[model samples]
Target: MTPPDLSVYRLVFRLGDALIRSGASSATTTKALLAVCTRAGLKHPSVSVTLGQLMVSDQPDDGSPPRTRFHEIEPGALDIRWRTRAEEITEHYLLGDVGLEEALEEIEDQVNQKPSHQWWKLVVGYGVLGTGFGLILGGQPLTAIGGALTSMVISFIFRILGHLGAPGIFGYAAGGFVAVLAATALNTAFSLDQVAVCIVAAIAARLAGIASYGAVQDAITGWYISATGRMMEVATSTAGLVAGVAAGIGAVRLLWGPSVQLIETVEADTTHWTASILGAMFVAAGFTLASGGWAVRLLALTGLGGATELVYLFLLEVGTTPFLSITVSTAITGAACVLISRPINLSSNAIMMVSLMPLFPGMLIYQGLLGSLFGLEDSGATLLEALITAFCLSVGGVLGQYLFSEGLWLARRRQFHHTHPGESFSKVMPEEYNSRDIMLPVFSKPFNGSEARPAGRTPKGRPTADA
Candidate 1:
């Protein structure tokens, strides 16, 4: 095999690592790299992802031969800042002002850029994020406080364990266990009525790592290996979380009289609208900080999160099943998010990562686990229902994306943008803009460059179809 273009190889590897590390899907990474290579005047490239590795192969348009390079996918936290910046770089490159070298350097810088916000600030953001969810769930001040504090502690512990080189799942389980144990104590000690809601809300933020939307998107796009791997990781992490929450409850029950009711309760709006709205805003804000997202993005997500919850509530009141409610509401959010991606200057995927935070299956899953552990009569049925709810949320989110992709509005947007040139312009990248398409997309920019021809694998003058 001939040696590949080191520059193209480096850029592709860097971009893929950053995207995957930030929770972008394998398909998204492939799309971005293909787009980048195309714009950079390199030949068509093929990209593949496994659990902790990625391979990129470049071929001559002539089909003479192909050369490939492999890179490892490191475990890292979701930093929306890098995600946004990476998207911006892709957009910038597509714009064509920056050369291949400069664009590659800038992307590298984004990958290496240190977090601008302090760890304490992140802690506060997560606390506020949990508090907002608690409020939305009708948690009183005590429950809100408990949820906020517990979330902060758990997030910190998750980080510490990551630093200690623990498998990512260990941190998730630890956080879940710790959060529930603390929330349970608060509920018992203070007699808070919304303990279940509060605990679920607090843990919701971390559950984003499960990458449900990405998995579905990849599967639909024919990346089954990537999808299966993602699903397995998500399932393992979710099980760990559920186990932790259940373990906490079991331990707590041993110490005290049934800490939380764990019995079925009717869904009702016990909290005022003002409280719920505030909760939504804080949850969005907190999500932004914890994920290293920007202020502008936070504002959009706040409104989106609130609207989604209101839709969810309305659906519930209208007698929709919880699963259906989550699905329909997420679909709506997904469509709106795609339309707003340009204006918000955030990837739809990034927005969805947290916009639907309120719609996470954490609460439902917790309830189901509680039922089984406590030996409720309907435990089996409840568990099945919870699984179905998760299936709905993931499928609905992707359905919304597919609907948008095939819609006239998105078509017009794509047409206008592709035809228009340089308006100080940046765009969230495709489905990777993409339904990432966590489902977040990197930005795409256009520039032109010619690479020197190599042995049998000469550069194809024009971009070809992606692999």
Candidate 2:
């Protein structure tokens, strides 16, 4: 095997880096990188994805010093435009239609792609997100209106922070703190019954899904370092959010007459199914706007949101616990993403990720943290339950992917290699190859639903199967 041209190596590096910074999971990014290189007919191209950097190299079979290239990556900010364009560039290259200059131009275009909607439009979308969450949780009219107001405040803070180019951690923390402060004030001013739902909704659009699906995939594939880094990023962002909310609530109590009650907002079984589905749609559309995704994708995600929430409701009706209900709900969503995304030219990463917005434990984090601080009854238990719920989500996502998509991914790789000799598989492709890879003897083919490989991985990050 000969070394790839230095320009091709550089293009590959840029492509992988763009995917990472655009919030593609380690597995998806890695797989996409390998696919592009293989299609480009590069020999023994090597790529390593770390927390803050991406490295790609071309190694000759002769064993001389390999030429390598790298890029420093800021933590990802979800922009579906980047991922979509990257996929196009890769597929175009694979079809043998793109030249080096075209690939470079594509990368440049992606890096500079602006949001599909205006800034003010995003603010309104976030407001809709808060309103949706409030309705889903059965908030009263006052609570729903207050939630929208609070979301606007949070959006304003984020915009200012973004304009100033502030550090991500501080910006997130500030948004959380301000959102709580706004909600509490609104609750007092309106003489509302409970502010918990309002506050949760205000920040619903901001809760970052744990890239745990990516962590699961990385750990499964023996990339422990990258896995740890990915998990830590999620933890740190969540901590910032918790601290900000805690501080904001504490400050309000100190300055005001009384402490804000840490009410556990619970909806009765009679909470309307239609309301849940509609609210889920609102949340999904809001997320797409806030994150700079295209309008067409939003239509699909909105429908998916409704369908998945119905699944969650069905599980609850069948007497499922909260943890189990969430797991099953996520599993259904994961399966839908796997079956639906490819034909539509959508990135599964974005769809599975935003689908989690309706189910994430945003309010629970605030209630648990404040409850413990105030020495409220069962506060400690609430906190413990919150942690358990999070663990369940991560586990569910991993299981969903394994059950739905991993086998198909493996089978596809096997078949591709069998048909086209001398092409290296993605790094996610296991080292050991057997007849199962070529024929999928162990699992069903894509969209077949014939084989049950037990519960699987992937909720958001790589849909648990890359998991």
- Each prediction's Cα lDDT score? 0.67, 0.66
Error of 2 at 330 (Å): 1.6
Model 1: per-residue Cα lDDT over 84-181, one tens digit each: 77777776665554667887888877656676345886788889988987787777788888889889888788769877988877777888778777
Whole-model alpha-carbon lDDT for candidate 1: 0.67
Q: Which ranges in model 1 have alpha carbons more than 4 Å from their true place?
A: 1-4, 60-65, 75-77, 116-118, 188-198, 208-210, 257-274, 317-323, 408-467
By TM-score, how accurate is candidate 2? 0.82
Question: Which candidate comes out best when scored by TM-score?
Answer: 2
For model 2, the superposed segments whose C-alpha errors exceed 4 Å read 1-6, 38-42, 60-63, 116-118, 262-270, 406-467
Q: What TM-score against the true fold does each predicted structure earn?
A: 0.81, 0.82
